[model samples]
Target: MPAIAYYPPLPLNAGISAILCAGFLFLAFRKLLRDKKRGKATLSITLAAVFAVATAGLVVGSYQQYVVMNTWSYDFRLEVQPNETVRESLIVPIPGESSLLAALHLIAGTANWSFIETIHGRGLYFQFNGSAGLDALFSEFAPGGAYHNTTLTMMNSTAQPGPLTVWIFYSGGGGVTVHFASGGMVMPQSESIAPGWRLHQLLFPPVA
Candidate 1:
């Protein structure tokens, strides 16, 4: 039901685009049939075909994006490596874990986040789609230690990008969540999430 309420519904948007495409095609057909003027008929036909193809392409593109990031969330991972030093400080533009989360965030609309912070230094766990991807993302500590591997997840439900864009600060520790939801399970504004979530949050935290 929640997912259903989400804007830019696949079927509806695609249907509308398809109709426009078909309308252009029909108009072109009528012109072609009414007066067999090569120049005019050719123009109409070309336009109609372009509109139809474009609309259909939109449907296909939207569907593909939906399928890939339907119920998705962005994630970042910071490895609290040995010596309390954060690794991967210098993130390149290459396709790393962050890249995946960045892409997912843009596709899901920029804002509408539910921040869940866990003060516990417990090992990080995650789930991608249905399978457990990042089981635990914590390095061994010499016993008592602070939260070296912390996750800052910015989750949102109303992320609808105009054409799928780029936002790096999205939520997820388990990877991009692409599963549909039946409501409930979202974190409150003031609460913290724990245990296992197939989401990841990664970015160089401000070092002291």
Candidate 2:
């Protein structure tokens, strides 16, 4: 099984990793001391090595979470009718300890969007945190460019990728228009969005 990731980095993940590392190391050390007292050098060394690896894993995991929380930036292309434009790179100051999901919520605020799954758009977008049951419809794909607007197709099908569209009508109070990527055809759909960027069900369901 793959190593579990800590979502909502910082205190949650950091704390968990810390505890795991601490508790495991403590056990490993006790075993080593006891074995050493008995002149069991081989077993003691093995336990020590395992303990080292565990500590390293925790350190790496904590760093990954930190990168996502603070440095991650999500660039969403808003698609609106007609020829009007709105700010694209959404960078709202949220807590560094917040998860990517929380960051997305902050940027989107209370704006509601609609998503339509196309006939061939039956794939799923695998997420970094790896929550099996999470819907790809609302999950982000990849980044496109510097603004990093690519999409990673995470479909659970063996068939070739199809098309998808999202019609986002921002209605928090006034009107918010976006650069729509019709059919959910985000650039580099085979790639992944940079850390920090989030993808929800920004697509309006296709109507018959």
Candidate 3:
């Protein structure tokens, strides 16, 4: 597992970096106007450039981390029925804390499955099959870039009874509260689709 990162808030570091960059630039201008020697003015300008680069690095790195951490929680419900009177079921939970790569590997290992990846336009899809009896589909928008939404489906087979239904939940801070259905009831949809996914696609569509 990759170590979780800890850093000061991006806005806070950005504010400080901007202040330092501006201060250095102001000093460079003052030195150029009042001092006869060019060396002091050149040094101040160099420091300003260094801070400017640092500020840009901070913004870019923070945005990347934000995208990775912005994921959803999934509850996979698998159901198998051998006869009209007998039913068997299994449930797997994939928390938001796990990276998408890790989650895929985990599921494959648990079910003895293999998968193939495909890219269509802006979407990435993974089709998985088990040696004994299982088949699944996984998909996400913009795999490594900004995350929007993900969907998974598993079909039932004779060896493993299933039409696995996955319920997705989105929340801020990666914390989710899942409600399980009981007594032959179905889980309610949080929405027709994830709100964040819809908003992101609307605001930042791929350029032609």
Measured by TM-score, the strongest candidate is: 3
Model 2 CA deviation exceeding 4 Å by range: 1-39, 72-74, 78-208
Of candidate 2, the 10-residue stretch with the lowest lDDT total is: 127-136
- In terms of lDDT, which candidate is strongest? 3
Candidate 2 vs candidate 3: which has greater lDDT?
Answer: 3
Report the lDDT tens digits of candidate 3 across residue range 71-135: 33332222221222222122222322223323343322123323322121122121212211222
lDDT of each residue in 1-208, candidate 1, tens digit only: 4565656666576777677667766776777788766776677677767767777877888777655554443333221111211211111011222223332221222122221223221122221222211211222322233323222223322445432111122133322222211111212121222223323222233458
Off by over 4 Å in 1: 1-6, 9-13, 68-78, 83-208
Q: What C-alpha lDDT does candidate 1 achieve relative to the native structure?
A: 0.35
Clashing residue pairs found in predicted model 3: 79-161, 80-161
Would you give me the overall lDDT of model 2?
Answer: 0.35
Task: Provide the clash count, candidate 2.
Answer: 35
Residues 76-170, candidate 2: write the lDDT tens digits: 33322212233222221111222222323212222332222333232212211111111111233223323332443333234334443221112
Candidate 3, run of 10 with poorest lDDT: 195-204
